[model samples]
Target: MCWFSGLIALSMLVGMSSPSSAQSTAEPAKGRWTSLFNGKNLDGWVMKLKGSDLGENYKDTFRVEDGVIRVSYDKYEKFNGEFGHLFFHQPFSKYKLRIEYRFVGEQCPGGPGWAYRNSGVMIHSQKPETMSKDQEFPVSIEVQFLGGAERGTRPTGNVCTPGTHIVMDGKLITQHCNDSKSPTLRGDQWVTIEVEAHGNGTIKHFVNGELVIQYEKPQLDPDDRDAAKLLKANNGEKALSGGYIALQAETAPVEFRKIEIMPLDD
Candidate 1:
């Protein structure tokens, strides 16, 4: 056999999918920080919003402006429960992800009251291609980012599970959202958010380098339709190790300036 063909077989034996430029879902070398966004365009990302196909951007809900990714609603006449996520092409088993974001101008018309200044990043998320049409969110764990008045005490870096559950302090946490210990951050000032996910062993949220919340053992919730489908396909493995990462657009105007990740050892 040819040397190149032998090398390909060896890679497959170790479970590494060859990179495709169309998908751009390539894995980086371990311990190296890589910038996922090129700051020029959305070349390696895919959009999936409500009532739209997997690759559809849905009325240009997400766009790049001034070297940043902006969730726009300028063309929308109304925000009718259209929740969306922009997913990176690949998944990481263990990594530290960091992004800078800020709340932008007015919320879209008819947006949810609770969604104001609310956005999140989904970690360990299901692949966008597998998401069913009309699925509001992927089966993942969310690192919620919030901006509001300091008096309101709305904290960023909170944990919110859409179709998942987690364990903390040796007990299972079944609730949907858990507030972080982050200080209140208001206005349009940019804030840095960081997430440390150790492949289902322990995941942590940090706001501006301060540890906010820590949890472990993120698993699928069988009662949820999306999670159930995932379980049926993955031999019913309840413990989630890793998956894709996605940015959230929950009817709130938000902007992300930078997104970087560093792969870690398992």
Candidate 2:
């Protein structure tokens, strides 16, 4: 070929292989991390407390103040096992959820002893409207959070299955709760917790950037009353892939500053 012709062909090849050209033609990745809690108000959230109707914020239990969403009971004279949940409006399939929380003051009087400094975020949860008027907890997977006591070792970032179960290490786990190896954060210290859920496949837990727990195959329990109805609607396919996210108000004062999620699917 002539030198001029060869040079022109090489220039065209270089142009085609340029980064800008490839980027313009490539399919873009989908999804982005977004703030679930507005940090200003509960604009996209609903409330459901045990023994009360849906949307009832018993004694104003859930509120937003100082750029934080708080589960407070200072106005109540007692704690009566009024298990409450503040649920996000949307449901998700595959995502990473992160939140920052801390225990404040003391557990309310009459609160369960086991509930001291205990609160959690429920994922893959049943809809609020489906829960009975007296249901304590919805069918979900709980990323259980427990503040450290002044005395002994109390782990945080544990897993608590309510009306559901998971498989770990290829074994079908039937335990109600599985403790993580994470260190206990005593007192009123801010702690960051994160969960990576891959639909009905695998789920993981991390605290302060350290991986503490991992499991797989989360499914609804047929024996659970609340979950039984869901099981039927799901065509008896126990695999739980998607559901709502809710924050717990289990007779304790807790504050959450950040609640965000990053979608995994396009």
Candidate 3:
């Protein structure tokens, strides 16, 4: 069987809950549950990056309309500047974060490449303000979300880490991680992604009831180029780890619904 298929089977065995079910359990539950996105506006969120343009010009790039926090590139004719990241106000060491997202519209101009249509949910990221003035993108583990242009591609809830590294099976798995399986869903379908982050740096990425990737100790790999750059910019490599979380607005348009968080007590 394929790696992704095996991951799906593993997710089933773990009894992971969907976003809807998890949200349902939030009310009057045994533990504390918090809503990351206010749904009406970007209340508890902050945007920061390298350059003077902290975000996508604060336009419709990251905004809330109706009840959803949408990451749209409708205003941009193209993605010019460096990288852009939208982060939550609170910093999390360990927690279960659940988000619903879907890609929309066509690719923007000056996007990355074919992969530019890609966007990500960054976890275990550094402080937004601490980033360099010329920094492009973030040095965090990206819970990559992808859609298929063709039928039967790969499933959603893929994983990709940039300028980050984690431990898996006692081995150091540095930055640059991707799903072996192609996306299976296409068009504008809302897919659910749930992540369980253990404070010690262990994390699991799940999509639509399937576990796509597992990682631990999210920190700069020390071997990656960006990690090296960030190290130089920050004056050290230890500057990473235990920061905040952010969402990507690469060149594609995407929307996030039900962005909620439940802190896990270690």
Model 2 Cα displacement at 81 (Å)?
A: 1.5
Better structure of 1 and 2 per lDDT: 1
TM-scores of the candidates in the order shown: 0.90, 0.87, 0.77
The lDDT of model 2 is 0.82
Candidate 3 displacement at residue 11 in angstroms: 38
How many residue pairs clash in model 2?
0
State, as a TM-score between 0 and 1, how close model 1 is to the true structure. 0.90
lDDT for each residue of candidate 1 in 130-218, tens digit (9 for 90 to 100): 67788999889999999985466798999999899999899999999999999998889999999998887899999999999999989
Per-residue CA lDDT of model 2 for 24-64, tens digit only, reads: 11121236667877777777788899999888889999999
- Comparing 1 with 3 on TM-score, the higher-scoring candidate is 1
Per-residue lDDT tens digits of candidate 3, residues 1-266? 21111222323321112211112222322146676776677655666644654433445567788788776767776677645678775566667888888888887778766554477788766556555667776666778877776644655566666777667778876536657343477788888888888765568878776777776655565677756754554435332334467887777878887877787765
lDDT of 2 at 6: 26
| Model 1 lDDT-worst window of ten | 1-10
Once fitted onto the true fold, the runs of candidate 1 whose alpha carbons sit more than 4 angstroms away are: 1-27
Top-scoring candidate (TM-score): 1
Give the C-alpha lDDT of model 1.
0.83
Pairwise lDDT winner, candidates 1 and 3? 1
The best-first sequence of candidates by lDDT reads 1, 2, 3
